[model samples]
Target: MAPIINGRLLFNQLPNGLPVPGKTTVYDASETIDLETAPLNGGILVKILVLSADIYIISRMRDSSVEGRSSPFLLNQPIDNYGVGLVLRSEHSSFKQGDHIYGMLPFQQYIVMPPATAERFTVLSNDAGIPWSAYVGVCGMPGQTAHHGWREFSKAKVGETVFVTSGAGPVGATVIQMAKAEGLKVIASAGSDEKVAFIKSLGADVAFNYKTEDTREILAREGPIDVYWDGVGGEALEAAIDAASVGARFIECGMISVFTGEPYHVKISFNIVTKELKISGFIVTSLHQAHLSHFYETFPKLVKEGKIKYKEDVTQGLERAGHAIVDVITGRNKGKSVILVGEE
Candidate 1:
């Protein structure tokens, strides 16, 4: 077979703020590979089909000496995120040709899965027949984050009110639905009226545009928040802390405002002691071994039955990946941002 374009996005430089496409990150299209003849070396050859643009990836774009959720991205290397891909060829027992793999795959059109790093990639059973794109978005890591984050952190009784920050995101939207499903009142916020409407459509009982509304006033009016689904950190977190009910549980799933700058001062730090507020944060991957299978089995069925609403904002091409990731970082994406690198 003829050689093919192996366009890959690289961490060209460390970002000072939100990364600029083609500047801090380099989209290299000059690379090419003969997929039919590429050596697998006891691993797999995969056509990168779908890539998720997640906020978590932004934290990894930093100095190697700096701490992050994972290792910092090495300069000139293909940066990666959670994605589902199609295996074109495989030299492993657990995977075979035509199997779809899910893991932290690089932002490339094609990738060689050398055995050394292939340990992280797992075959997507896809038993529910959910769209492969969903496997990278609502049914993927973000969903697991919401499901387990809610299940583990939320111990509120029925009729409780939970305020979900960054409420229009993949994780927040899912949390909103789950809270409503369990008979809890959902108060969530987004960056725009459109996003506020989207979360309301998912049954958020009280949805607000945090960008325009006074975060503190609104949470105070509608809450004594029984649970704070804290995806947004910084000032929003400060507001949530003030609005929290005595003994409120704070579920820390993400702190995305690191890109937006840290505006949090914890002036009400005394509440943690006086109110007995329970604040807990979890790295979703650490909890997935016991819970991800339940998410994989149940969330897709809920989405399919229209019982749990979900959405995917699919960017059309790999060339747009850098922009797609920027959208996630800046809260510009309308739904779960996914870069469609190839036909699923």
Candidate 2:
């Protein structure tokens, strides 16, 4: 017998700031599907096991028409992001009942994808020896973002000094460690003292709380930086521009400071020409195929050997997903924000 599925929907659009609780509605539905009687036409039904709560989802909530990305969630539709799930029934040749998979999925308890969309799902290997949550995190998109941002965008070389902002967050944390592994001298900045220490423990040569210190002064003292991996924009980006060495590469992965509809005015435009710096902005989706493949092949080995480390700040239950997203955007989360939707 198929189980009843409860789903969460975005009840309203967030025009400016943080998400409100009532904006995400939860309701029970009577819809159910029997695996035996399900039609085999390249469709698949999955039981969602984990949902990733990230600032990127917040960006989507603010505007539904973000070009080169998934269409924004409709007024009453379920929010979608990366998720891990178990196949309950499958009509696709690549998947079968009982298979675990990861892909872009909704925040609901169960989902049905038609033939065209079903191709987005990828089967998870049980022998991978990593937690499912890792698939939505370190071993997933964030990991790929870090790897490709450094290798292709930043073009960091051995012994060069690199600075990373929001170093305690998923992508920044991975960037810090990967830079260290490749023999780069790494300096990291975070919002709080605890987060500063966390990045330091991950092998950052120097870590500081940007909240308490002036980023410009800190970078001036520690820099002449060859590469800058920017996760937080606004003031941090201005600081990087001012502190960059000649021919430095600035890889812009995100701008969390302005994601909540805050007004941002870039004040360091003049420095770009004066310093001969190369600035590039990237979305992980553009480099997904090559970087994701390289990350999967290499990252797990580093995780097993203790050369890389990751952390997930998980909130239990799907209901807390909104709160988790708010917490991560506001710097309240200590690690990667994740919603534990089911038992491992």
Candidate 3:
């Protein structure tokens, strides 16, 4: 039997802050995957197509898993997040060869799992008229996060003022457009001048480079925001708190500001009390599961009708996965960070 060659990025050590070059090592697995072997009953084999590189994955790489944080990445193993793939073989009734799917897959070229494990993945619809990469980006976790954050947490009403941080990135871009589609006035912040223009192009009523301009000044000029869809936490969060309306809603999403072990102190606890604000933090996975039906029913249609737009920044080649992950964490990618591991 011929040995199946698999290349993967192995977690080398706990990142002290940002992932250093040597923190992860790329290597071909010693154990060869046997393609000729039949899968166990209720199991499937898949060839990974696209992989997601996200900041949340970085938070999990620290030595001790924060008490309330997601499961930490196992040391000396392939870093697992999500990916889009095609079924190569299956022993499960629900899945078969050539079926397109997306789910929490490891950063590897291929995977094999049991039925219970397969339940985490969803088979894609061919009629969706969207690209396979969309399943891992806009139509996938980031889209769901944007929708759920606004619908459930922000509960933003039409004609209200809304603010978003990291507005050029995937989740933030979606939030900006969604807020506009819902008739809310949007003020967004990004790290660079180009990102600011990109956010504005996405229909943000006002967009500014938070790195250059003061977030507080921007919000004050676009004052009394009713909802703050926070992506970059730290000073952005503080500015949101300061600029919040009396009964504003704060939808806490990513905290890229502190992803690298930096400290963030929101010196405005008094405002939370005095302003009678509603602040909520969420994990997109739980929200996605809770609202899977609605998301599948509506989000795709929106994408099809041109009501929703998404962008993907794809880095080609499996060998570049380590650099891709670093780029995403450090805000080097322009849109949703994705790695093309295989042909679509």
Best by the lDDT measure = 1
Question: For candidate 2, which ten residues in a row score worst on lDDT?
Answer: 24-33
* Model 3: lowest-lDDT 10 consecutive positions: 22-31
- Model 2 CA deviation exceeding 4 Å by range: 24-41, 63-70
RMSD of each: 1.3, 2.1, 1.7
TM-score sort, best first = 1, 3, 2
Could you tell me the TM-score of candidate 2? 0.93
Query: Sorted by lDDT, highest first, which candidate order results?
Result: 1, 3, 2
* Residue 140 in model 3: lDDT: 84
Model 1 weakest 10-residue run by lDDT: 258-267
Candidate 2 overall lDDT versus native:
0.80
lDDT of 2 by residue, 255-338 (tens): 888875466787978789988999988888788766777777888777766778998898887677777878887889988888
lDDT of 1 by residue, 24-63 (tens): 7888889999989999999899898899999988889989
TM-score winner between candidates 1 and 2: 1
Candidate 3 structure quality by residue, lDDT tens digits, 41-92: 6789888999888878877786655665677777888888878988988998
Cα error of candidate 2 at position 42, Å: 3.0
RMSD of 1: 1.3
